[model samples]
Target: MMKLGFDGKVALVTGAGSGIGAAVSRQLAEEGAEVVVADLNGDAAQTVAAEIRSLGGQAQHIAVDVSDPDAVERLVQFVIDRCGALHLAVNNAGTDGVRKATADYPLDEWHKLLNVNLNGVFYCMKHEIAAMVQNGGGSIVNMSSILGCVGLPTASAYTAAKHGVVGLTKVAAIEYARMGVRINAVGPGWIETPLLLDHSDTVSTRRMVALQPMARRGTPQEVSALVCFLLSEQASFISGSYHLVDGAYTAH
Candidate 1:
């Protein structure tokens, strides 16, 4: 394991309540970063924060709905007020919208999905980048998905939102690279997360395995490891890039 230091650095991870987000929060805290666990589920966020504290790591919890721009702004201010600075952020809060073909996808669900997955990242970056500029420099990782780079049957809304995330990340990276802020995106394949489990029946499991060249599902830790690297100085030269931790699912 490559050890990276985050001493005196503050990180904000949305969706830190579970899955990859929770894993990232714990790893960052273990590496000496004060982590803010933000999630729409208040209880889950608090649980993750408390667990970090028990391990003698610094962590705080905030209940937030990322789809709300006002709430995201408040989240940034809260971190500044409590931690005094925002040096890292992971815009990982998102939702898997209803699985349906584009022609059959409900308009309301499409709007709702885009609101959280796409617009939410933009709102977070808007506030997080401003804070980073004031603090000199920082790094940001936006959570996209393998679907972002390819189309999936019955997943029109999700694919569109994730694709938007990739585009947004690239634009922000170019606009702020000189200012010391590095923006990037992570495209994950089928991982062992609750969201995935919810849809994983025997049939789905076979399908997912067949899609990945590795012939298996990835663990949350696997994704978190990549995310931590991006947020660390180890990835100082990296920006405006979409990294796929997809078990070579897109290679074909």
Candidate 2:
């Protein structure tokens, strides 16, 4: 029973205040990793970290806007200063901008979504890879989405950013494979996260459900399981690919 072994590792998960990111942070903590729960919401990040601590898990929290390269640098540095090494990271922070047809999409909205969704992943990876290389080796799981592989109407910006994430993951993984850094992307379907629920109406939700062959949305824990496995030694040979946890939403 290898159990995805993380006995003595330091893991950082962004957007970990809630949903899949939060679940991954907690699960990583349970696997004996010192977890750093990073999110844009300072209070939310602290709450999650405090909850992990209450459960006797070694955990910490930080508020970081991943879109800023400078802030991302500071974040990785913070992890090094506090934990001494960065063994694993999940660049999961992102946003689903307002829905609109590509032709009707607002220019500001497009930039805003890309800044956090696509550019943010790049920023985090840029710094995380450096820290991991310095530490000799590490793993990373960047959050993509079902949209990364396919397109959805009225979600032009989100779809584009996610697709970009997949490309970025592939290029980085290839570049760092020989350097002891394995990078991969996880594409989650319509998981029941605030990112979807907060933006969807009842009818919209039902429509999304119908789109999935599973006829339901996925749970954060389900996705977290996959993310943790990828970040663990069990997945040492897996890198430079996009793994989907979608409920077969893209099968059709």
> What's model 1's overall lDDT?
0.94
- lDDT, candidate 1, 1-252, per-residue tens: 687889899999999999999999999999999999999999999999999999999999999999999999999999999999999999999888777778999999999999999999999999999999999999999999998899888888899999999999999999999999999999999999988887787464468667788888999899999999999999999999999999998888
Q: Count the backbone clashes (under 3 Å) in each candidate.
A: 0, 0
lDDT on C-alpha atoms for all candidate structures? 0.94, 0.92
If candidate 2 were superposed on the true structure by all CA atoms, what would the RMSD be? 1.1
Query: Candidate 1 regions off by >4 Å?
Result: 202-205
What is the Cα-based TM-score of model 1? 0.98
Alpha-carbon lDDT of model 2: 0.92
Question: Which residue pairs come into collision in candidate 2?
Answer: none
